[model samples]
Target: MFREIPTVNRLLQKKWNDKDQQIHLQKLKNAKSTFNIKKRRSSSRRISKSTSKKDKIQEDRFKQIERDNKILLQKMRRIMKNHSGVNLPFEKGSLNKGMRKKQLADITLANYQLLQRLQDKKSNYNVLKWEKDRIDNKKLAQRIGIFSSTMVDPAHSKSKQALPTLKNPRESTTRMTKKRMKKNYQTELQPLEFPSSFPKRAKTTTRKRKRTIATPEEDGDKAKDLDLAKVCSIPEEREVIFQASKNDGKKYEVEISQTEDKMFIAAANKVKHSEHYLIELEKEKGEEILKEFNNNFQVILDNLKVISRRLVLLNPNINDPKRANTTRNRTRKKNFRKLNKRGNASQPSLRPGTVNSPSGDLMGVMPETARPVSPTQNTNDLQA
Candidate 1:
């Protein structure tokens, strides 16, 4: 009923309160916009805060730089005022003797160290270079002795006698035979048969150690149950251990140690004495022998050749013919006839449990194998 008048007024009026309608429309737009508030206010506040923080930092840095420059200037002024012209921290005016001396020492030391460092690294740094070009791949290889050796190829050999030819045995047969003969002679070397030989070599006899019953208690209770031995490296340690030795009180016992050995080595320090006994010819002969032993390898080789030749001449009977057995009677071979009975059937035989059967022409017999289990005797023996 209240809206009927307003409806009639809206119909009657062509432009019914346009300004008021615009105001209402503007109010509605304002109300819709109010739902979306400006989020940039807090962001703008943060941005302002960051800018202020940056400004503060810049100001602090500038203040620090100014302070440092002021301190440096003050120090420079102090240095100029001082007699020593040193830039060390000083008292208001003059320093005490101790401080002055310390400052001078530090200054001198610094100057000396600076000079030394400059002397070592005197290369001109002003001249720029990409690289100094000191690349050497074989530097380490050059230092190693084996790498430095002139010989590199494994196939290259120096001696006329090349490696033994395994494919062709005849190629190295002469050398092989010679080496075998020399080895045989060396292994079977015996002293010359001398009628007046007084036998100077001592004949020592090895005494057997008495056997003791090794009980489990004795073995387990002993401190040396472990196979590993306690080793002492220091002299003091060994000395401390000497008192606990089992042979400490024994007069007949001899103690031997692994280290700190003062047992006078007769050959230490001094030039090795003449190996020649000097009982033979003269000093000249001795010197010649010494020189031959030390240097003249060819001469030694020649001497050895002569010795081998002499040995060949002396041992002309290298292959002794196999002598026939004149002493040993050659018995005629006994013919063993096969029998037709079990050789192991001894239960019904003359001797019970004996692995034997009646020896007869028809009895079965186990044939004896020709292969001899025992080593054959050398027919060339003096006994044979």
Candidate 2:
């Protein structure tokens, strides 16, 4: 039975080994099939990815080429426009460094020439204008009698030569007097003939008096007193009355009284007639003075106006010949003259042959008569 058991165990072991071997083989076949399928799928995916990448690269290259072509076209058009009339090696293209520098130099030279021509024309015009102005000024000066024919030449003018030698009248007189006095003094000092028997006069000497100083006792007695007066007793209240006169021949009273506190107070029953009269007098005096001042001021103003009118008529801005000839200035001056004439004509005239005084009165005329006449008329009609 033990030998049979060994055979049976061998047979079981063999069968189990066969079953295990079959299972392992089946697993290997399944694994090989799955691996082959996976490898085929991977290869197809790689092929598709490579083809797509190539197509994208080609598209990008074509787009970049199109952009570059557009940019080049724009540059070509700009170069053609800029170099239109310029003779260059490239007729319709951009210039190189040397060509660009040559073109800039040519343009600078043309600009410089144009500026020089303009300056020359301006200088010529200025010269002509200056000559004309010089002639006009000479004529104006001659007409005004400011420059005579001979006086036009400064070197020939005697006044110009003598101006440096001229001295103030008072200074010259003083210098001449001093010189004569010096001569007289020198002549007087000459030795005078005298008799030998004449007694010699003694020279008297003068002594200066000295100032005296005050002693302490005298200074003490001379000290100033600054003490206030003392009151002995308080007095009873008393009223003092004052009367004043007015221009109307009326009298008013002012009362002054002493208070218990030693203060003196003044009270008026009514406004003082004298104060009103004084105030009225002051007002009248002030008005008279103001009237005199106004008359004098008006006389001066009229004289100034007349003088300014004469001056304007004489020269009319002779210093500036250019401004004097403008149409606007001429019209303005005409209007001013018309206004002045109308004002002068409208003003009342003074009595014939009456001289105007600075105090706004006519000489040899009563104040009443002068008061009726305008002060401006007398001054304006007086000719130098």
Candidate 3:
């Protein structure tokens, strides 16, 4: 019974082992299939993405090139329009660098042919000019008074005619002087004023000053005594005044110092009613002279007021030519410098028939050369 029980257990164990192996094999097969599908999908997606990025880059570059080409075409069209009068064989669409080279070569050939034709024409015109000059000389010789005559006059005619009688020189001078005098008398003369004088009115009249009445209450006041002492002690001083006059069309103001000499002269001029009263003097005329000085200053003040009014009426523009000339000159100098620089740049490469020389070489000197020594100086002095 033990042996039979062992055989049955072995058979059951073998069946369970076979079932487990089959389940594991199926799971491995399913896993391998899913893995292969996933790998294929990933590879296809990567390839599609790479192709899309490449296409996008290519499209962007093409668009940029097209934009640049359009801009270049517009610029070329503008040049063509500006030179519309010129007969160009190239089309607007074919104005690229390679096409321009061919066009330039064709133009050079055309210019060479035209120059040759012009040279031939110029030679022919020179020949015609020589012929015309020869014909003109022949015509000039045919006219009378131009060349020697062959036939002589039948009448008794001498080789040279007699000279006419000379007229008297005195008659010519007398005739000219009389004509000049007549002209002078016919011209009008300007009227002149004579030195004379008329009765003159006095510049001012002296008025009698009114006297003030003193109050009765101040007859015995102590304040009056103090005022009298102060007034009597005050010091006297000579006053100065300035006088202005026009001399040689220029204004001059002088401070006149009081002197005893001018005092008597001023009094005499005042009594005589003379126009030279300003140059005269008087001993008691100090106040009057000061008043005249003030009158002169008042006249100057009135003139200044008139000048101010004139300034208000006048409108001088700030941007006038006289004011802006300095600015214009600065601009002109700057432009001149720019032009000189441009001229130097344009001639950087020397021409075929020209020789290029440095400044020192043109001046007959070398940059490293030493100056000549003076004859009075000794060689030992130079060495020291």
Candidate 4:
């Protein structure tokens, strides 16, 4: 029995040995394949002697072509120098007059064609440059806030007058008056007066009052005395008294009297009459009707303001969120749904699923089912 158990163990060991041997054989075969691949790569990268010889031949041929080109260019330059006129170098000393004339005409025609080409190119370039300048000027005008017909064109600006002109009548009048004053002053000679030499005095006068004795009499007797005093005070008698004086000093008399005529009386009367007439006309026309309409309109505006204030007070939730929660919750739910929809639209599918999955499953094999039409595509289709 022990011998049979030992034979069974040997069989298991044999099976393990066969598996290990197969694994080692696979590793050795892989190593040999890799070595062969490296050898092939190295051999392919090596350059052949025949290719190097071919490269040298090609280089020599290119050099010869370059040298030939340079020699031809030098010969052409010499020929051009000898025949600088319209005549060709080959026909420079030819005795055939008709051939020379024909060559000269051909050269002139070629020159005219070249000149025309050059002129056309120049005109095209000028037109393009003018268009660019116009675009740049428009952009500059926009930046400078100048949007009106008065914006001057740079092309036509040269013909405009550059010097300043007198366009304002008031300014021109002031300049003319200043010139006239300067001319008048130039012809006149006057001595300048100094305030220190002639001191200024106040334009006011004072009078001496004559003393009168009060009479203790009745009102009628007082009135009679004043009349007699006034009759005795005569200007001629006073002048005679002054002339009879022995003193050589000058005598002056001042009189104070009230006059019925005034300089501003007529003007004051006319102004008062005009003001009274205007007041009467205004009353007769009932101009207060305009004031009544203005007052009523103002009252209506005030009432509207009051109603708006009351409405604002009643609906505080319009600005304040703490006043109500139902509206806030509704708005939050709407915004949340909108954000979820946008996220679903923007995210790509990373897992296998049906095309019509409610949660936005995008995996599918068919082209029409794999990709969904976006809002932008719909808008483009509509526009088209």
Overall local distance difference test of candidate 3: 0.40
Estimate candidate 1's alpha-carbon lDDT, on a 0 to 1 scale: 0.35
Candidate 1 lDDT over residue span 1-384, tens digit each: 223444466744636556668889998888754365665456888899999999999999999999999999998788778856445885575548789899999999999999999876756652323222222223443343233222322333234355864566656557889899788555434322434645465576798768753223323224332111222111333221111112111111111222243210010001111110101112343343435335433322222211211110011111112312223222101111111132322121111100111122221112222321112334233120
TM-score of 2: 0.15
- Alpha-carbon error at 282 in model 3, in Å? 99
Looking at candidate 1, the ten consecutive residues that score lowest on lDDT are 263-272
lDDT of 2 at 132: 69
- Candidate 1 lDDT at 219 equals 32
Instruction: Give the TM-score comparing model 4 with the true structure, all chains together.
Output: 0.14
Where does the lowest 10-residue lDDT sum fall in candidate 4? 262-271
Pitting candidate 1 against candidate 3, the one with the higher lDDT is 3
Residue 237 deviation, candidate 3, in Å?
99
TM-score of each: 0.14, 0.15, 0.13, 0.14
Q: What C-alpha lDDT values do all the predictions have?
A: 0.35, 0.42, 0.40, 0.38
**Between prediction 1 and prediction 4, which has the larger lDDT?**
4
Model 4 Cα lDDT, one tens digit per residue, 167-216: 77665457888899778554332223323544456566577668653323
List ranges where model 1 is wrong by over 4 Å: 1-43, 85-384
Better of 2 and 3 by TM-score: 2
